[model samples]
Each structure stands twice: as structure tokens, then as C-alpha cells.
Target: MHASSRRQTNCCRKPSTSGAKAPDLGNYAMSLTAALNTALMGLSTIQAQTGVTSGNIANAQNPNYTRKMVQLTTPAVGGDPMAAVVAAIVRAAAPNLLQDYYGATADYSRLSATTDQARQLAEALGIDDTGGGQTPLQSRLTSFEDAVKRLEATPEDTTLKALVVQRGQELAKEVNRLASQRTTLQSQTQDDIRTGLDTLGDATKAIAGLNAKIIGQKAAGMPTGDLEDLRDAEVAKIAGLVGVRTITAENGAMSIYTDAGVQLVGTTAQSFSYDSTTGTIRNTNGDNVTAGFSEGSLRASLDYLDGSAGALTSSDGNVGAMEKFFNQLNSMARNIADVVNAAYGSNLFNYTAGDAAATLAIDGAFTADPNTLDATRMGAVQQAMRNTTLTATQINPAGEPNGLSTANVNIFGLVSGVMAYHARQVSDNEAARDSAENLQANVEQKFRNLTGVNVDDELAQLTVLQNNYAALAQVMNAIREMFDEVISIGR
Candidate 1:
């Protein structure tokens, strides 16, 4: 309600001639008293304006606090049209710019998460971004191949024969280590997803609580500027986590939902939880909306786990970078075992028919006695190891077709290609991330300019209000002195 008051007073009138009817006074006369009341109203309004300016100055450093100003509205006071009230407090909020900032933030978060996770994968593979001749897997293959060639050159040399066995075992161990990293990385992805869900749930719940408070305060005719600022910050956080669309209610409440129409919050917030056992996320509605995520950090994590969304694979189905690299290592190991065994027309390496790369091992008999490799078949083994035109089928032929299935491709060349592919992935993603970062910064700055506070402007407004306040105080004093002078003359 507006701050106003009504006063009634008895008016003295001259006796009517010959007992005629007395003239009626409708209300208080519009004299110095009215002028004094008007000045008082002006002082009250200015005081409210100063309060708003003070708040703006106090919260100038607050990123979420938008600048506020008092809105004066003229309300009719009994037949007087000049009465004004501090009707409302207006905020410097721009809906369109805020929405744009939220959108840019979501896109940038997804891209950044994808790139950061992939970089971890590159590190796990021992894939330095530098474009050296070969990667870890490729280097192992080359060293093993060189050992085989040395054995071929001096078949009677026992030490060279032992060296070949040692090289083969070392290469197999490398494949085992890289394959293990995939499991570790996948587990890490799951933990990250759970952490993200916690933040999303907390933000949604806080927004819902704020919505309730805002509605109550608005109904009570109170200002909800601070509560609204906090709520908007939470909403922006949710936008980056899940990329939501917000709907504002008539009573200053807000509802949140994904673009697919799944409500995350109404008067009460919806609950979201992650189940590591099933590797899925379920909302309060009991629906798994993992695949429905379009853009956000959650979407990036989902893609990494599924190995289908943001994973880096070169036509090896829809596997991620780690899985793809594991497949390549397995294929190379089987090829090494199969080629060497076939060259000798005997089982030189102990690789099972349907086992993984970790199963590739040198035959115990060869490791025990190097003289066995001094046979004529050693020539064929050297030629097979040096062959660059080996087909995928010639290499292993038992497993499913994969990235290493290109025809007439050398094993070392395949490893080198994967290394180069990862290097390009890191480079391309970093470039895209930089672009997104710049765009996000640009839109955010524009949004802040429209809604954020300027301390200098607020201070200037404060000075002006102070001057008006001083003038109103002087007017009140002058009116007091005039009333006293009138009383003295009457005495």
C-alpha cells in the first residue's frame, strides 16, 4: 500500500446575516499546510530513491545483482491529481540477453568438457601431442620387428634369439597396460557423471525454494530483488549443466524444464540421481533421460561413456578414443603373433585363437633354448616381419573387422595412423574450444553491460538525491518558522 494519510479539521466561519444557512467547507484548504505536506511526500520519495541507490552501490561487486531503480507513480488523492507514491522498484534485467548468455554458456561447457576428457585419454595412451615418427604402440612394434630382423641376420647367435623373445613379451605387456587404462578411464567417467548430477540436483532444489520465497514476498507487496538475483544465478548454473528452458509465472515464480518438456522444477524441485551399477541417470519421474541431453557438461560425459557421442574413432564402429586405441593394440598384437607363427609353419608365439592382446606371448620352448630359432624358417620369419603390404585378414582374420582392417596396411603404419588421428583430435578440439570461449565471453560481457551496476553512475545519483533531500529539509524548516510567526501575531 502507498504511504498516505487523511486529516480532518474544524473551520471557523463568519455568522450568516439574518440567520441564513452557513457555507460548507468540503475539506482542508489548499494553503501553506498543503504545500508542506507536498514537500514531505517529496522528501519521503527521495529517501526511498536514496535507499535504492545505496543498495546498488553496496552490491556493485555482486555479479548476480542487477541494478535497481525506484518507479514513482501518481495516484489520485481525493480530488488531488498530484499525489505520487513509490509504486515499484524496477530492475535492469534483459530477458533476451540473459537467454543468449545461457545458450552460449551451455555450448561452451559441452565443448570444454569434451576436449578436457579427450585430453585425459590422450595422456592415458602415452600419446604426446608431438607428431613423432611413431606412438608407444608403434614404437613397441618397431622394436620387436627390429629384434626379429637381428635374429634373422644371426640365427645361430643365442643372445639375438633371446632378444626377440624379450621384445615380443615387452610389446604384449604394453598392449595389456593400454587396455587396462580404458577400464580406469571409464570408471572415472562414471564418477564424474555422479558428481555432475549432484550439482544439478542442488541447483534445481535451490531454484525451487527461491521461487517459493519470491512468490510469497511479491504477494506481501515486498521487494524480492536479492532473492531473485540468487535464483537467476542458480538458473544459469542449471543451464550450463543440463541446458534447460525457463518459464516465468505470473506471481514472479519460475518453472524449469529440459527442452524435451521434462519438468525439473515447479513449486517443488524434481530429484535426479545416478546409478553407477547400471550406468544410467534417472529423474524423479523414473525416466532415464541420458540420451535426451542435447548440450551441456552432462551430455559430454554421457557421450564419453557411451563411446558414441563425442568419442574419437576412425570408422571402427562408434567407439571412443580409448576403446579405439585398445582395439588397435589388440589387432597389432594378434598380427604379430600370427605372422611370426605362420612364417615358421609352427606355433612360435603362444596366442590363443579368440583371446585378447594380453594373451600374446613367446613360446616357452624358444625362450628356454634359442637354438631352435636357428632353423631355415627363420628367413621366412624375418621376411614376414618386414612385410609392409600385409592385409588385415592375413594379420589375424579371426576377430571382427576393425580400424586396423585396411587392406595392404603395415602394422607399424596402422599404429602411426592412430597416433596422428589423436593428435589431430586434440588440435581440432582445442581450436573449437578457443572459438567457443571467445563467443561465450562476448555474449556474457554484453549481458552484463545491460544488467550490471556502474558504481560511478550510482554515486552521482546518490549526490543528486542528497541535494533534493537537503532542499526538502530547508522547505520544512521554512514552513515551521511561518507557522510560529502566525501564532505570535495571533497572541
Candidate 2:
């Protein structure tokens, strides 16, 4: 036989010595092949781990990105267990922490929305006139009172009467300006509600689509880490717009609902509509659920626009604080006009009944001729300003009784009371917003620590994977060399 064939035959031959058995070349070959296959699989696993680590490092700065990990598992092959293999990739997230974050986000958004609206209204009414320590309304009303006092002191001064009429005109002008601004704010709030509803609807649809995709991927045994991250982000956004509850199914599908148990997303998304005119929210079934949202910016805006605090008692119910303030100003203007007309037997101020604040003006008789100002009624008007308790009923912009029975105050007392009330509301809202925001920041940091990628940890994992890759490659190269040597011997 040729030299190479002789060697091959001896390799397969049994030992000639008595009681000795031949070597199992077939089994040895099978073992070598198995070892090679195992080594290859280890190399592939290390490579996949390296890729996962690299992705983590790449997305370290992405706030929405969650850290990913590969699960290693072993399987038996040919009666022996193989090395660990990459079984699945999973996103690292603490469900409890994430849920807490969602709640905090909703709270922060609600307080922020309320605070912004309150601040805007306060500014419009000049309630926050820190520069002068007095709002325009307060200053104008004070000037009118001073003019009245002057006329009281000199009951026959024609110039003083003209001055009183002029002050009344100025005060009426100021009240009208404030009312106009409030109307503008209401319109703007309506627009914002419409826009927010649109955004919420879009978010819900996207979540539903993602739910379908995730369910399909899970069924197909595909990786769903990225999809889950995207879904979580969408969920947070929706929570900020409206209070929500979530449920996860075994199929990896997520269901979303409002605090009021209104389903927002499931296998299919539910559509939403907002009626800015009536300040109503409805679902695809057209059912009114205005009170469904208990937390979120949408709820805050609705509360401010509708003037309903949802109180139980009639004295504090339905009427929003902003609308109540408007009504109080209207009542004060009406009371001033009524007392002056009754005492003087002449109309001194012209105003509509319900909208005195907006329609209040000096009567044409008084404006055309200062001599028409009745000084005889000056004492009664002054008494009304100082001691008369005027009662103003609260009503919403829709002219519905808000259940806030009555707000009682003297003439200038109502003006000061409204101003003070606005300042207090603004202050309280700011404090609440700040507290919620701080809590949200702390919660977000904790959440990031739990689920966010750590650069140092990822780097260490990458180093380990690199070493594993090198070791596996070396084993593969050694296997190749051994196979080549065996082939040479056979030759």
C-alpha cells in the first residue's frame, strides 16, 4: 500500500496484543465533529452578545431606550449537552417603576396645565401686579371711591361730580377690558382642548398598531425589545394627556384604559372626540364621559374652562372659580348702578343685568352733562360701597347654574376679594406644579437607574464578549489544524 494509505489503515486497525481492543475511529470522528460544531456555536453566541452590547452603548444617550440583554440556554445534541446559546433577547425594565413613572408624569402634566392657566388669568386681571402692589382693577375702583368721598365732602362741587362720572367711566372701561381678556382665554383654552384631543387620538391608534405588531412578533419568536420600548414611550405620552391604566396579555399585547375605565386601546383602538363648545369628551360610541379624566392636562383645561370644581354642595359646585370671579365683578357693577339709581331717582350707570362687568358704562345723561350727576344720592352710593352686602350668583359661560349659590361682598370689597382670590389660586397652583415636577424628576432618575443602559457596565460586558470571541476563534482554528493533520495522515 502507499505510505498515506498504510497510515490510514493502521489508524482504523485494532491492537494485535492479546486482550486489547481496537480504537473507535468512527466515534472519535463524531466527537471531533461535535466539538467543532459546539465551538462554532459558541463563537456565534459571543458575536451576538457583542452586537447587543454595542447597541446598548450606542443608545446610552437615548432617554426612551431601555437596556437589552441576551438569555443563554443549553440544549442536548447527540447525547451530550452543548455550550450555552443565545435563546432570546429581552429588555430590562421594572414594571413597578415604570408604572410609577407613568403616574408621576400624569400628575406633573395636570398641575402644570392648571398652573399655567391660573397664571394667565391672573395676569389678564392684573392680579399679579407685583410692580405696583395693586392691580388695575383695584386701582381704578379705589380712584372711584376717592372721587365719591370728594363729592361727599363737597356736595355742591360741579367739577367733583364730573370727576366722579369720569372715574366711573374709567372703572367701567377697566372691567370691560378684563372681561374681554377672559373671553379670549376661554377661546384659547377651547382650541387647546381640540388640539390635545387630536394628539391623544393619534397616540392611542399608534399604541394599538404597536400592540398588534408585538403580538405577531412574540408569536413568531422574533425579538420585541425595540418594539416594547416604542410602545412604552407612546404609553407615557398618552398618560400625560389623560389618566390611563394598562394591562398586558400573555401574547405580549397591551391594553390601555382611562381612569374612568374607558378603553383607549386594545386589539383595536377606540376613537375619541372633543366638543369644545360644550366642553364634553366622547368615545367612538358617542357617549359623554367628561368626568372620566381625573388626572392629566386635558382634565385641568376642562376644569378651568367649564368652571366646575365638581364639589358636592350647591354653594361650591359646578361653577369654576374663574367664572365665579367674573360673576362677582358683574354683581358688584350691577349693585353700584342699582343703589345709585334708586337713591338719585336717575340712571347714573347703564349695564345689562347678567353681564354688568362687560356692559357697565356711565349713563348718557351723566356723560353728556356732568350737572346731571345726582349729588343727593352720593351718601347712599358711598354707604353701598362701604357696607352694602351684594350677592352674586355663579354661572358658567354656558349660562348654567354652577351650584355655587352666591358670592357676597361690598362694592370695593368684591374687587379686592377677586384680586386676592386670584393671587391665592395662582400661588397654590404654582406650589403644586413645583412639587409634582420635583417628584417626577426623582422618579425618572430612579427609573433610569433601573432600566437605562450603564456605559461602564456595557463596556465591561463588551470586553468579556471580545475575549470569549477570541477564545472561540482559537478553538475553531485548532480544530481546523487537527482536521488537516488527520487528512494528511490519511493521504
Structural similarity to truth (TM-score) of each candidate: 0.84, 0.86
Candidate 1 clashes: the total is 0
Q: Model 2 off-target regions past 4 Å?
A: 1-29, 150-159, 307-319, 338-346, 355-358, 375-384, 387-410
Per-candidate clashes, comma-separated? 0, 3
Question: Which candidate has the top score in lDDT?
Answer: 2
List lDDT for all candidates, in order: 0.73, 0.79
Model 1 lDDT-worst window of ten: 1-10
lDDT of 2 by residue, 1-491 (tens): 59999999889997769777766656766777988999988988888889899999999999989999999999897678998899999999889888888889999998898888878878888776658577887788789888988998898999999999999999889877876666677788888888888888888888888888899999999889999999999999988988788999999999998877878887788877888667799988899877887778988877776654353223521126456656656655666676656655677777775532446888887898988777877887777667766655421222433223335666566666666766777888889899999999999999999899999999999999888889888998988887776666555
Candidate 2 is scored at a TM of 0.86
- Cα TM-score of candidate 1: 0.84
Candidate that would win on TM-score = 2
Residue 314 lDDT in model 2? 34
